[model samples]
Target: MVRVVVVDDEPMVCGFLRTILGSAADVEVVGEAYDGAAGVEAVRRSGPDVVLMDLRMPGMDGLTAIEHINRLPDPPHIVVLTTFDADQYVLRALRAGATGFLVKSTPPEELIGLVRTAARGHTVLSPSAARRLVAASTDSLSARDRAREVVASLTEREIQVLAGLGEGLSNARIAARLHLSEATVKGYVSRTLDKLGCVNRTQAGLIAHDAGIVEP
Candidate 1:
């Protein structure tokens, strides 16, 4: 079963989500919280597979809470399921490590499927929302030029690794494709991240895509 913890400041929203997802045979409402702090506590206690988080909650807020939760030894997948998807908050939430973004207006069945996808470590984004995010990013010529310079620092083999990462391939898959050891692929990925001035693989992929190094 995919255990879930629903968090929102409003009781009605929390109850509504619980009711909607609770009906699924593959889903279980392990706990609920009215604010971010309580949501953190509930997540710890319930050991849920996914967290349905409201981005604008009081007392720590969803973005802050997600950062904390991500620091846990075994953090649950986080889905930013909020009424608001403004540029500022949505971008911040994604940067803080939300597994996906789902507006509260999403259909219940679709929401349930997204929750399941997140539980399995998938990166989910509504198609329109994703386009919006990409368009929202400035990606100025300077930034793209800088990104190209950064990418150019990598060896040809490492460039291949970045392309694989942009396609969401794991270390093992990259290794197989390149006829190299998994450890070698991991090293290439790490070096690419360092060269790209990125904090993680996800950021590197984003930069590569935006710079047209990896193309969409």
Candidate 2:
């Protein structure tokens, strides 16, 4: 089952999601919080599969929470919640490593489905959010195109390892999933990182995300 935590300053919003999420047979609402700090604490303690994060909370807003989640060993997927017109916060949240963005007014019926999709490592961006990302980060194409060109020089095995890492799989997990030895996966990961000119998995992930090649 997909476990979720909902973080919103408004108590009603939290209750509403709890009700709707309760109706999803494969999903469970594991926790709720009124601010980003409390939300971060809840995530550390509850270990939910996903977090529905509101970007406008009073203290240490959702973007801050995302940074903390990124530091975690096995972070929960985060989907920043915002009003559609709040383009600035949406982009900030995405750059902070949120897997998706959802409008606060999204129908309760669709919320659970989107949450499920995000928990499985898929990203969500509304049409307006997509447009905003394209506009705000048009420069990404130039950098992304250059990065892809460099990455294309990787050997097939290195490419596979890089793709697995882009999907957030640990080296051991990648080895088991790909039917390879752990040491081999680690070696491939090192070579892939060097070939792509990326120092860490996050940078490589950003490239993969910008290039739209790694889904789930």
lDDT (10s digit) by residue, model 2, range 1-216 = 999999999999999989999998999999999999999999998999999999888978888988887788888888888876447667667666787788888988888889887876655654344444545664666856865787778887777776676666678888998899999887887777677765455445555555555552
Q: Which stretches of candidate 1 lie over 4 Å from their true place?
A: 84-86, 126-128, 138-205, 210-216
The prediction achieving the highest TM-score against the true structure is 1
Count clashing residue pairs per candidate. 0, 0
lDDT of each: 0.77, 0.77
TM-score of every prediction relative to native: 0.74, 0.67
lDDT of 1 by residue, 159-193 (tens): 88887766666789889999999998888887887
Summing lDDT over every window of 10 consecutive residues in candidate 2, give the lowest-scoring window: 126-135
TM-score of 1: 0.74
Error of 1 at 191 (Å): 8.9
Instruction: List where candidate 2 sits over 4 angstroms from the true fold.
Output: 126-128, 137-216
CA lDDT, candidate 2, residue 37: 93
